[model samples]
Target: YVVEELDVQNSIYEVPLELARQELDVKTLDLLRLDRRTLDLADYLAWLDGVLHPTRECTIAVVGKYIKHQDAYKSIYEALNHAGIANNAKIRFLKVEAEELEKGDPARILKEADGILVPGGFGGRGVPGKVRAVEYARTRKIPFLGICLGMQCAVIEFARNVLGWQDANSTEFDPDTAHAVIDLMAGQRGVTEKGGTMRLGSYPCRFRPGSRSAELYGVSETGERHRHRYEFNPAFRARLAEAGLAATGTSPDDRLVEVVELEADHPYFIGCQFHPEFKSRPRKAHPLFNGLVAAALQHRQGR
Candidate 1:
């Protein structure tokens, strides 16, 4: 009589999986692989030790309103993990409510952060707090990365604080606002349908030759996934650029700004319209995430 056990937890087949007895024997029933690459266990063990036992850890604060549900930013979390692995460091996320930032000093709340991440989201619920957090990162010289709506909030903050546009805001939040630093895309003009009408999927962003975004990406042109209807207003681009908030990347036809970055005066402050997290993989970390992690590591070491 023959008995079959699936061994679902251990993932073992008909036979048990054990360490090879010194050297693998082809005739042995416990052999797991037929290739030499699989037999090289020494290098694998070294890699495992280094990765599993990182020398240092970092705390990156994710300032957003959806902290109650992590799944809202699952891709961003995974991308940060991928970047952590690439840097051989452990990353811990500190969830900060955006509403709190508006009520008080963001520096006090984000004081423990090795880096600050402002993720994408819709609506005007916690925008003031997000702007405050961006202000904290910018003024404190902390490593900062803003995505999608985060980018818009950064623009609003810059317009208000730097460009003197006291009432700067996004059209999505206040359609009648005087200074709409972020406005609805041209194609989305007067579109009543809200379901899946955003500029979704992959789109190419042309980077400036010597810009920070290009340097981090190591390419002049790259495509990233985007899911948004609002974008940086072209009318305010010149003012923002003249004030040092340069548009480092733009759409293929140069009709839309895809990336904005502070100059060399700042340690690392960048914002992107595309969601870089969606492209990150376990083995392949996205450049934007990798850059953020690296900058965070540097910031931690310097302190």
Candidate 2:
């Protein structure tokens, strides 16, 4: 088998998000080039091709630490597959060792993917890799779908790389980022272990007007089930927004954050503080999952 020479530089481009938007050179965007021979710019389409089945598809790398128990993430995987089938495509799932990503170059595996998803996990054992992958997506303008811890990593990635917050971190992992973007809830009690002390179950979210999620679910305010403990620190919301990151969806009382999308521009970059997969069915896929698959399809067609 002939191996393709890797684009090590593609690991992370330092282009400002807006500049990346202006220049069509980024790998994640449409790889279309002008057809000088004909003097008419042609829309170069990259078919899902060999990668797709009856349901055309793109490979999406799901980098996380909990691959051992597919059941722990079963709902999530199935929901993605459901979306693929509904859209006449298959959602490719790849589980990777987070430490491998952190210790060395993960650009190869990350680049092979049409999208990257960072799911929830506990402890700091594999968080840096998750954050690294988020950085890959953010800078490259890749179709990124972050959930729970994934959302936290997306925030941490933006905090450190774009906003210049040096010690950005989740309190779940470290209590000491210069700015603590994540922290434990103050009102909780009855702890058996640090493991189970999280806020779980269903919660309400108040959406910002004209947000991507607000339009997808057909309402500004909505409810979704969750199985997590740590929440975004309420104090950092404004700081994050000022830096162009949005806590677009929040709880009814506005105490808990629910979803975050790009402030503006880019196709489908969304991170949710909740797992919508738990409620997705084979027939009716969750809107969030549907949205992610849609982005992958767009990326595959060189858009």
Candidate 3:
């Protein structure tokens, strides 16, 4: 359409119809067309307009180890784009290497970000950096969103800093740590094979009545997809809750922690065990990503 100057920018369906009439000499193209009212393209055009020309802008620093690979976090990047479109803001991604954060000062490396996001990853290679990034987001009052391993990092950071447990860590990194805020799922303790053994697929999650997560989702119950084996250790849940990291969302039976958030005065700080980005769409952004983008814009304005 852009090349041919066809009046099909409104609806993608128009492109083929126009091509048939203009080039292929299809006389019945108009008759074959569906009712215009049934195929309204207004909403699609509006969404495209927002994408082509966003009114606002904010930088979200994505702290992760896979910064070198473009497609490593493709879904996450697209989810952020969808969220930016919904908010009428252009997302400026500040891709910070997790290792770099460990080597340099986090505040200086992340000073330009209006929000900080720690994405999922495995192993202990850049975990300390991820934890440091979470700490930066927490203490500096920046809008933050953590997913999977990122969420684990948040819990570890809170346990060590706020809960005053210097040795707080995930057993995945330090099995001998005195405080294992994040640990392997009970069922996976004796598993020999690692392949195809993760807690995969959709699972029901119930949100706390007055939590920020529930407010953003506007629903008490929903299904989020999971792809990890390690989870928030239930053994430490009570102590963590006492120190103010509330597990706002959990499994249907309330046994597994699905979401955690700071209940205090921070504008927006939440971490989810599942990858909400997997469900985000261009026209219908996922609630969590939308919330993060909205909060990021607010933080930018405040600054």
Candidate 4:
């Protein structure tokens, strides 16, 4: 009214209260049930609340570069929730910025973390921090899950600290590094275009017979979503395997490394090139997430 009185030009209109109320009423009816079922909104909401707000809680630190914008890892966060609900525990996600871990010991920052997850991302902005977190989890025997670039960090950390490769790094980070432990995938080579060029969508991975990943997944062959151009360099596969980083899963032809895991003694340290979080559901959590949550519960109990 004041703007109108001042003779101000504006392209805005107020919605009628009756019209808004009618729209709300229609939406409410539409959302009352999932399908033509007897279950109502109230009952569903109550059940959902109970599942989400559990008595037991476990803290899982998600160490990543994009800590400020969580939507980058939205699927991963939800996967944790699904796994938490499955185990009757509430997931308390701690967003640990990668830049902070580079400065000093992550112990001070991740002291209370029952589990540590290094999810997918690109670039070298916080790579050092992530590598430190991987080392912490490895030596401390804390439950850990590394996805995509997280897996690359684990390999790089192992190469530098365990295998004594001082100058080891991903080609994606340092194209002229002495050792390009992680480099561009064969299919993605010589591609100048960045958009939609990644090895995206579902791909199959075959698990080794008695590997921890096989046990966790309860299957030899399975598929998961991927969005990456870089892959574990095949040239260094022998050295990585000799250093005790078991190549648990691989591509159909066994040329590409899909999953890497530590020995049985490390509790639950597993990393995958694919994104298991993409397929995770509220009722049925991804096996990797489920295992991580379960291990976290045990870690908390021990601590």
Q: Each model's C-alpha lDDT?
A: 0.85, 0.75, 0.89, 0.85
- Model 3, residue 220: distance off in Å is 1.0
Could you give candidate 3's per-residue lDDT for residues 1-303 as a string of tens digits?
122333544454465445544644333434677332223344655677788779999999999999999999999999999999999999999999999988899989999999999999988989999999999999899999999999999999999999899999988889999898998877788887775448999999999999999999999999999998789999999898988899999999999999999987898999999999999988899999999999999999999
* Model 4 TM-score (2 dp): 0.83
- Per-residue CA lDDT of model 4 for 1-303, tens digit only, reads 011122213222122223333455445657885333232233434346548467678999999999899497899899999999888899998899998999977889999999999998988899999999999999999999999999999999988999899889998888888888989877776678975458888999999999988998899999989988888899999888888998899998998899999874788999999999989998788999999999999999999
Candidate 2: segments with Cα more than 4 A from true spot: 1-55, 68-70, 189-196
**TM-score to true structure, per model:** 0.86, 0.78, 0.89, 0.83
Error of 4 at 129 (Å): 0.8
Model 4 regions more than 4 Å off? 1-53
Cα lDDT tens digits, model 2, 199-261, are: 677888889888888887778887788878778878888878887888889988877888988
Best by lDDT: 3
TM-score of 3: 0.89
Each candidate: how many clashes? 0, 4, 0, 0
lDDT of 1 by residue, 1-303 (tens): 122222233222212224343333433534664444334334434444445677777989999989888588888889998888888889999889999888877768998999999999998999999999998998888999999999998899999998898999998888888999999867777678985458899999999999988998898999999998898999889989999899999998998999999884777899999999989986688998888989999999999
The CA lDDT at 11 in model 3 is 54
> Candidate 1: what lDDT?
0.85
What are the runs in model 1 whose C-alpha is more than 4 Å off?
Answer: 1-47
Which segments of candidate 3 are over 4 A away from where they belong? 1-37
lDDT, ranked from best to worst: 3, 4, 1, 2
RMSD of each: 6.5, 16.8, 4.4, 10.7
